[model samples]
Target: MWIAESVTFGGSALDRAAPLRGDAPALADLQARGRIVPLWQGKPLIANGALAWVAPGSPVLAEATAPVFLGLEDGIGWFAQDISAWVPPEAEAVQPGFLDPSLQHHPSLPADHTFTELRAVMAQLSPRHAELAATARALLGWHQSHGFCAACGAASTMVMAGWQRSCPVCGAQHYPRTDPVVIMLVTRGNRLLLGRGTGWPEGMYSCLAGFVEPGETIEAAVRREVFEETGVQVDAVRYLASQPWPFPASLMLGCLAEATSDTITLDPAELEDALWLSREDLVQVRTGLHPCVKPARQGAIAHFLIENWLADRLN
Candidate 1:
């Protein structure tokens, strides 16, 4: 299929400036002049259908800030503030926050807003906002989950501008973890294969995917996932694209595999159903006329692959 050069969070203009993450003095200065994006329990601040970035002088930054130093953009530093402790009484928690932030008190702020979901607003956000939000969410999630050292069971402190966690007692340095997942667009002649899990909404089918094994290559992962889930043999697998899916941190490896067998043996434990659809069937589905399958949502690599397959753009 066609390679998507610009996945949701892949194409961005921010200069990460990895070396500067270790500069404490520089980081502090950045916090003073840089803009702040509040993440309530890891959900980015959203307003007017986009991410809400707070200025350095904003009351929220000065009063309730627990800022995690994000990278720079256009030479201007950026940070994300964890304000989960200050959620309003009547407001409900959003669906996609990375993990719980232990907040003590509510801060003075406006009564209402549009939304606070990162995935929900990703497609509508600017590339800058999307990249920053994804970075903040993944970084904060790592800190929340890795607060203690695995080696010596010691508490770890945040370091490297929220990029690394260091254990105080063990002196162990830990970095953020990202899981790799192989998402395949398997095709046989003019048809493509799609699978739906047990709990998914009815008629919603997308690419077959599974996590990468310890010793397996991306190509091996693609073939293994397809057979394990659907019992369909595959060959001629080639990589297409990659996407960073930060719902608790996963790197999606998108690939295209040509199925050698037309018959499918369904694995009920792994998939509720798996089937082949022709190019015409995809056209109907994309146009909202197909009855058996609903197209994948926008901004997802699955959607990107399917759209490209229909247009014969998989070069």
Candidate 2:
């Protein structure tokens, strides 16, 4: 909680410049000196541990069709484009993966440039890069998924500089929506509760999380999720930090809670297993000495909470 803003995808604030998003003339003027960040297949170009954030008139922007205005910084406009639809030129065939030794160049940019998955290189990026990448992914993914108006089933047009979609026939407007998920750090005495989803990687465990239902509060959601996932009743829920998890769109509301009772009830449909890990157990996992139950990976709120708990920083 003390290091709340240090969480990967939530704390960093990207100036959206919402009003300017609707100003075509102002946007165009800014475009003359603005920078564009292109996303291909949900990944961004990373050169020397930074986003390309190409300047106006770059080859990348020239090839991009109808980019979304991201926001502004220092009077310079920022925009984003999803070029996943663009077909790449021919290249030497190789295995497709980050592990492949050879570099994969951008289809439009120079041969030295390459695109990498944000998650794979997020830790290497600055706080701003992570924030912008999350913003772009969420906005673009929303556009990709919501192509029609839910109210009238009419085709929608991108408007508000990518902040909204409008259906001309119905006069309906749709904005990007983020689903709220409650992730709790439930503790009883010196032990913390962690659960592994049914399909999670072996040895991987994290805090209990579930989407907040309609008409539910964050505190209630945390209590309900912890109880439903592991049959552990918790009370006195307190907010911690949050993260923007845009693997299609989610806002993780991290919280800390006090368990009223310790009881294990496996929701087979929700979790593969649930267990209580003490500080020593967590230390072993952190040290890679535990036989199973690896700590949540860095950059995740679960890991952030656990690390802070270990350091007596969570308040």
Candidate 3:
């Protein structure tokens, strides 16, 4: 597990500067000198394959929400802001699909910079930018969806430099939430277990995964998820690596599990299809030679784990 943090969004080594979260004067100073990444409807602004950073007073942030302090790099503060309030002039450019390919441009921003889906450009960004973008997206999305306090049912205001929400009615406080999910590489002999979720892209398959329930351990979640989806009983489960998947907010716990049973009792409610593939078959799929199966998206933990397994680097 030494390579665990080498996964995308985990090894930035950015100093979060947590102590400054509660200091108004210190935060204000950082805000004045720090660069900000603006996100539109969850998509970060990218320019030439890198995160597009602008000054705190940039005109593009006219309708932006309060900035969230991401961290520090080389003694410079990094922040992210949500400009979801601004409407794109050409709404039609925004497509509706599993992954939106459309990009949005603001009149005040550089013509070369556009708001693009993080997934589409995640692999292209440097580790530091990728971590910053992921943190920003997750934090901003949390603020948007958790505006109301759970305890008092009252609207909450952003506090702690956007790391928390405070309710004025009941004085309740809430922090950003990250759900834990187990994505396992379940193998029996030389074959791997893969499942396709309903409505996923045709032929797309990935490691079986499920959310870790309350009071459940990661190992237990991996075993239960594989059994529930493919009727495969997992015997030995071991941690592999992890990724911060902020498509809303999820921390993907990647693991390798040895399967004790191979009989697939398809759970249609959980998967559209489930099957086993030998290491050789995975080689074909990886190289795009498989006739009916597509490998998981690159940069995802599933793909990373599978690649390492193929190269015999899992040890």
Candidate 4:
């Protein structure tokens, strides 16, 4: 796991600048000279295969919500603003699917610069840009969903540079929440356990994954998820790498586990199908030559784990 940090969305060494979160003067100064990443409906604006940054007073940001201070690099500040309120002249109806392939364009931005889904271009972005996009998406999504205080029914106000929300009625402060999920690469000798959820694309299968329940350790979560999903008993679970999955804010904890039992008793509610693939079969899947299985998403931790396992780098 020496190369663990190299996983997508995990390796940007961006300086978060925690202390400056509460300093109004400092943040104001940074905002005046910083670059901003505009997001629409959770999609970051992209141009030339990278994050397209705009100035603070860009016309595209006229309808933007409060900006979140992302951090600084090379003495220049980076921020993210949500312009989800702006309606496109001819907005495409929102598609009901896992990943939205539609792109949005603001009149102020160049024609080449479009608001794109992060998953569609995550692999193409540099480490720094990927990290920034993930952070902004997750934080903004949290704000949208958690507008009301949990402790009280009163609405909350953004504070701490978009990192926290304060409830005036109850004097309660809430921070962005990230749920932990364990995605395991369960192996028995030369075969790996794979499962396909309901509604997944045909021929698509990936490492079994589930959320870490309350009071459960990472090891326990891995074992439980594998057993619950496929009736496979796992032992000797070890940490692999992690990915920040921001579909709605999840920290995917990747793990490698040895399967003691190969029998699959599928939970109809959890998975549509479960099976094991030998290393040779997996190789074919990765290369798009397998008849029954498609490769995992390229920028996902499942793909990272499988690629490393194929190369015998899972030590």
- Give the best candidate by lDDT: 4
On TM-score, who's better, 2 or 3?
3
Error of 3 at 50 (Å): 0.7
Tens digits of lDDT, candidate 2, 129-176: 788888888898899889999999999999888889999999999999
Worst 10 residues of 2 by lDDT: 92-101
RMSD of 4: 0.9
Give the root-mean-square deviation of each candidate in angstroms: 3.5, 2.7, 1.0, 0.9
lDDT of 4 by residue, 29-50 (tens): 9999999999999999999889
| TM-score of every prediction relative to native | 0.90, 0.91, 0.98, 0.98
Q: Arrange candidates, best TM-score first.
A: 4, 3, 2, 1
In candidate 4, where is summed lDDT lowest over 10 consecutive residues?
A: 89-98
Better of 3 and 4 by TM-score: 4
In model 2, which residue pairs have backbone atoms overlapping below 3 Å?
none
lDDT of 4 at 221: 96
lDDT of 1 by residue, 20-52 (tens): 888989988888888888776667777676767
Q: lDDT at 27 for candidate 2?
A: 81
Residues 38-103, candidate 3: write the lDDT tens digits.
Answer: 999999999999998999889989999999999888878889999999889877267988899998
Ranked by TM-score, the better of candidates 1 and 4 is 4
Which prediction has more favorable lDDT, 1 or 4?
4
Model 4 / residue 131 / CA error / Å? 0.3
Candidate 1 stretches greater than 4 Å from native: 1-3, 56-65, 94-115
